[model samples]
Target: MRTHNTIPAFGLGTFRLKDQVVIDSVKTGLELGYRAIDTAQIYGNEAEVGQAIAESGVARQDLFITTKIWTDNYAQDKLVPSLKDSLAKLRTDQVDLTLIHWPSPGNAVPVAQFMGALAEAKAQGLTKRIGVSNFNIALMKEAIAAVGAEAIATNQIELSPFLQNRKVVDFAKSQGIHITSYMTLAYGKALQDPVIGAIAKAHDATPAQVILAWAMQLGYAVIPSSTKRENLASNLLAQQLQLSDADMAQIAALERNGRLVNPDGLAPAWD
Candidate 1:
């Protein structure tokens, strides 16, 4: 079952993956049935992702490609052009979705300014959808004020079993903005939890599968990346893993505000 309408419930994420390593990951993922590929300018792997896609023999129309604009390009003058550069690198004329990589550092760029530029990028057909990432409740309000909630496709965040992010999740739900849960595995930390292990054992699934299923069951889109083919295939199989209500509650109790993606200057004051 897909989440967020057009967005796939499960996708391949490419963060901290670079060069041939990223290239191989994406190619293998596409072969393994991953249709959505997430990359960011900051990830420095868009071109590699594009290459893998171009070489994978999968038609462009069959794939859903997403890329994020880095903070340095938040300026109105730079947003669209930067996206165009990303498109060129991705070997596509338009991406399925594009996002603000992060909020303007210390409000260096106003919400309306960069968001308007992103909307214009959509208007010009540079991307089919536009959204934001790592935005807090206040920032989401500003984005909605700038482009209306209907225009923002999603708010991708560092969501995992250990960092449930209920406050941000609730706010996004109230406004009808979809949530995209990045790092749903908490960098593999949740896989080691005894509670998750018990649940996985009960279902005959991996801990990663349990966590990904939990997120998807909550109606959030997830993009979990892996360099190994076995892990990639297993993660995709997570779409079929169903957790019992008891299993859900057990995982819910594991939330202890564990966040692994916070960068000093680049991250915003989270919700």
Candidate 2:
């Protein structure tokens, strides 16, 4: 599997996973050799994820679990307690990584305050690392300046074939900031695109596989979600699928700045 700074590049996204679905998905993913699981306070399924992990028979040390703090929990006082709640729900003492879900524009807490809280959480063993999600270049710079370079591990964002995000990806690479690409399949839209279909056919793979391979080739960590066993299995196999330079160029040409998830009302301009 591809890895970025020691973290696995391929993970199972649990954005909308819940109850038995989340539990079964976690169990299936773990059994399928997925060491990374992504959850969030907003996902409302940490409890199920925890239950699945507990039942999966996988050692906690061998798994990399990630959770995120929602916008309402940004206050310094609220941060740690919120994390504790997440811990309880996840059934773990410490997660591998914790992220700020979104930088709420008007309610945006000072990077120093919350980042300091995150650092404190690390020191207290609440999480092994801390990072942010939906953060653009300016916010990432501010966060690094506030939290110190070594403390910021990653910046998760919406990235896929249609929204390549080359500028931010390039900037993150320069700063040694690894990126986790959520919505890497464009919420399943890319699976039906004619161009992607042709590329997948050329490689004897599915369109989802082709798009995911492209993301992996560009060195972005990917988290693609699916409820079906076949989809999950196919997605994991994306690691072994290779796209030629010409294929990559064609995929790159599909970028139209299309975004699948834009809770813009919850945050400022992503760019």
lDDT of 2 by residue, 1-271 (tens): 1133356789999998889998988899888888999999999999999999999999999999999998888898999999999999889999999998888657568877888888889889999889888888888888888886567788899998889888888888888888899988887788888999999999999898899889889888888887888788888999999999999999999999997777756655767
lDDT of 1 by residue, 69-145 (tens): 99999998999999999999999999999999898988999999999999999999999888999999999999999
On TM-score, the candidate that comes out on top is 1
> Which parts of model 2 have CA positions greater than 4 angstroms off?
1-5
TM-score for all predictions? 0.97, 0.95
lDDT of 2 at 269: 71
Candidate 2: TM-score? Answer: 0.95
What is each predicted model's overall lDDT from 0 to 1?
0.92, 0.87
